[model samples]
Target: MDQITNDLKKSLESNDAYCLSELSTLFSDRALTDGPHINEDLNTCYGGVLNELHNVACLNGNEVWTSGDKDNIYLYNLKGDILKDFQTSSTSCIQDIAVTQSGQLLYTDDNNRSVNIVSNTQIDTLIKLNEWIPHGVCIASSGDFLVAMTSVDWDHTNVVRYSGSTEKYSIQWDDQGQPLFPAGYTTKYLKENKNLDICLADPDARAVMVVSAARKLRFKYTGSSSSITLKEPFYPSGITTDNYSKILIADMCNQIIHIVDKNSHFLRYIKNYNLRSPRGLRVDSKDNLFVAECYTGRIKKIQFYR
Candidate 1:
């Protein structure tokens, strides 16, 4: 039995496909846990250094990259001190921002029709699009990044995966041949769940769409019908997933953060800490949620999980 186990291990390690499949299943076994009875407010960092806090990307411990309706992106610590600031290559406003596992900063330049990376304070065009204008971006666990883009005419929208600068595939339509995402220039935030599910927060559709890693339609979570406080229509903007595979989405119009399970089950609502027009959501390695309030220009850090 020992020899057989060793042989099996060697075989798995030798095959990348088997190793990745096993690793994915191993991680998915960890189920989501119920959050704390009352979430704690950690700190509030002023992102008003920009015009408006549009998005946030977790860089490392207690540090995050923030962007607004401008070409410049600022890096700030939780203490509200600006660590670094860099401007995009294009003069137009940045659509979204994300940080790679290696701590590299990436942002979408819709006007330039490209995705760029910031290295050593220099901007490098990583992926250039001819027909689609990139908006939202997120780095997957596999190091591949996903970009949500709309066509030049703003008549079509989809999420495309890229391995470095090479296009792997795209998730555009459902099994029924219907569009997976709504068309338009509306912002669509993308994040990969622990279960390898591609979750997108589409504000134009007024729904949070979750698809399998293979691009299969898993589920769509509209707002909770039973909630009394959610008087406005569901307008999901920024999206993120925690260590427990729990998904959190920012509802800008309602000023609430909705938490859902990997299966799209409504878990709870985070409406504390005076979340005024929360537009971007990001969770750190420690499970601390950093919310970017658009109009307020503030980033609120909260410990929602116990």
Candidate 2:
């Protein structure tokens, strides 16, 4: 694993892929957990992975990890066995979670009020809200953190970066620096591309906006019909870019996973009638897709080839 990640970094340095500054931030030293595993224990909870999975990450000994509307994060081994069950002490439901390059877990609740760190033993509050609400959290390859936030007062939303657990940069409705959207924008999800770029799923704007490794707008990619536009299925809820450079979008309304090229070419849709309100989606090292069934409280595992 070290050799592979190092090779990826060297390739970035050599411009083999994109510069390290442009790809997603997966630091050189931090690894949450390793390998892929199935999670059969979840089957009883939602009738055989019914496909409403909310959030999934790699942690503990499992190749797969996930969290639901409930206040628990699950770590499952590669074979789909449950490992550690990290509970939130209190009955707070976590909406999204991001694993840093340092193997640190950071997340926010559905209400987007505070941020917490999930460890082997305890859950600690990293940041608190006197008024503002924090929505999503992401980790840069260099170990920095990017978070999506919103205002408690209005429809305003923004993104910010932090050093470790401290605020380093913030974006608001100021003429000085506006994020991918203005005040009305709501950033639901955030992830780092292989090139270290930050990809955000903004359902309101109905697009996937890209911020460079340096946190600058690289581009915004929407789906295509005859010419390349984000039309009906444009309401992107959950998003992830796979190893094949395909963007997998969870069209919550459409009940399918839409795959497009980096340039937003309409590839193919992974549609299954069973998926319901898939608010979160993730890909394991093996390229198998794990979806979080948001409403029904289920996690669906779809094998790419199978």
Candidate 3:
């Protein structure tokens, strides 16, 4: 508590990018970290969710698919039963997951060595990393493939799109020959909707940068603080989209999740649970919430209210 805050303060003062990145994300979720489901008391303030998970994904049904630290991939029913525990390759760790538009399976690892394409055939590929480490992957509404990329050490991040047989690496915004995030940020998610590839950028600059699927910069949200200054953390991660065309971001460091409308208005928040660290938010066809609990290593399901 106090120790973590003080440590964070010191780290921020020195401009340690990783710690700063962590802090920025922490404050963004502070709005809900103290909800009853999170702290059990309004006065007892804290940040983050109540669970842990290595990775998480939502299926067409209310079910959730997750990987625990125990070297097992489990498909869970709503009642939390192990419906299936399909053993993956011994050393293949699950990092990111994306389902097809028709509800099939696709996932990528941090190493970018493989992309799992699921079916009865269970096809998968370890895409050789020629330039960057893979952070997130998604199938756009139009069925294009988009991969979120970053330097191995998290120095630079970008979104690259593959449509049909043509591939384009994005510059600043999504156009070719444009400069990607100049500050060298790590982009965690690419969400496609309404024929647009939406990039949710989580840069070390402590803000959310939005860009088109083609990698064009749309807008940037550094996030606002209720306090007088922007000292609160704002490392935005685990991005998902809602029905009304809003974006949901997991403010990891603060233990809260924020919902921003398509117009980017700060909407209501979900602070009902204590999160150690939440990342990789996913909304199913029904708009149910699923998140990867980074620190404790468990994936917990969240019910959404309109």
Instruction: Name the candidate that leads on TM-score.
Output: 1
List, residue by residue over 123-183, the lDDT tens digit for candidate 2: 7888776666776676655577777876777467777777856987665433455545545
* Candidate 3 lDDT tens digits, 182-216: 44534466565432436464636666666643344
Model 3 Cα shift for residue 4 (angstroms)? 51
The list of candidate 2 runs beyond 4 A from truth reads 1-53, 60-63, 77-82, 89-92, 102-104, 110-112, 171-179, 182-187, 226-233
Model 1 score (lDDT) = 0.80
All candidates: CA RMSD (Å): 4.8, 6.6, 13.2
Off by over 4 Å in 1: 1-50
Between candidates 2 and 3, name the one with more favorable TM-score: 2
Q: lDDT of each model, Cα atoms only?
A: 0.80, 0.63, 0.57
- The lDDT, on a scale of 0 to 1, for candidate 2 is 0.63
Quote the lDDT for 222 in model 2.
60
Q: Locate the minimum summed-lDDT window of 10 residues in model 2.
A: 27-36
